[model samples]
Target: MEVVNQFVVSPCVSVCEVDERDICVGCLRTLDEIARWGVMSHEERMHVMTELLPLREAGDVT
Candidate 1:
């Protein structure tokens, strides 16, 4: 028998909300990105993170 490994995703249990600065208090996802995450591709998520990094550094969100 062969054993397979499964990947687990983050739970994002934070109750953070999207602030006017476009950062989620919890997940820190931008408003536009968060609104589109369900339909976005993995590449898109990567792009969003690129945009988010700067904001995070500036203390925009958690």
Candidate 2:
């Protein structure tokens, strides 16, 4: 039997606090996105990662 493992890495960065906009101060991911990470596919995870960089650069951090 062949075992296929699909893994999507998280960019938690160990700072797990949410800002006023409900976005994580560490990863800049919303509460919903963080919650859905486990079930999200590799593509979905990559999409979210791609979206986060802009938000982080826009000063989403606290």
| Highest lDDT against the true fold, candidate | 2
Number of backbone-clashing residue pairs for each candidate, in the order shown: 0, 0
lDDT of each: 0.62, 0.80
- What TM-score fits each model? 0.52, 0.72
Please give, for residues 1-62, the per-residue lDDT of candidate 1 as tens digits.
99654332322447667677767767666666667777777666665556665568577744
Q: lDDT value for candidate 1?
A: 0.62
The top-ranked prediction according to TM-score is 2
Badly placed stretches (over 4 Å) of model 1 are: 1-11, 54-62
Show the colliding residue pairs in model 1. Answer: none
TM-score of 2: 0.72
**Model 2, 1-62: lDDT tens per residue?**
99766576788899999988888888778899899999988888987777665767687632
Q: For candidate 1, give the lDDT of residue 45.
A: 65
TM-score of candidate 1 on Cα atoms, chains taken together:
0.52
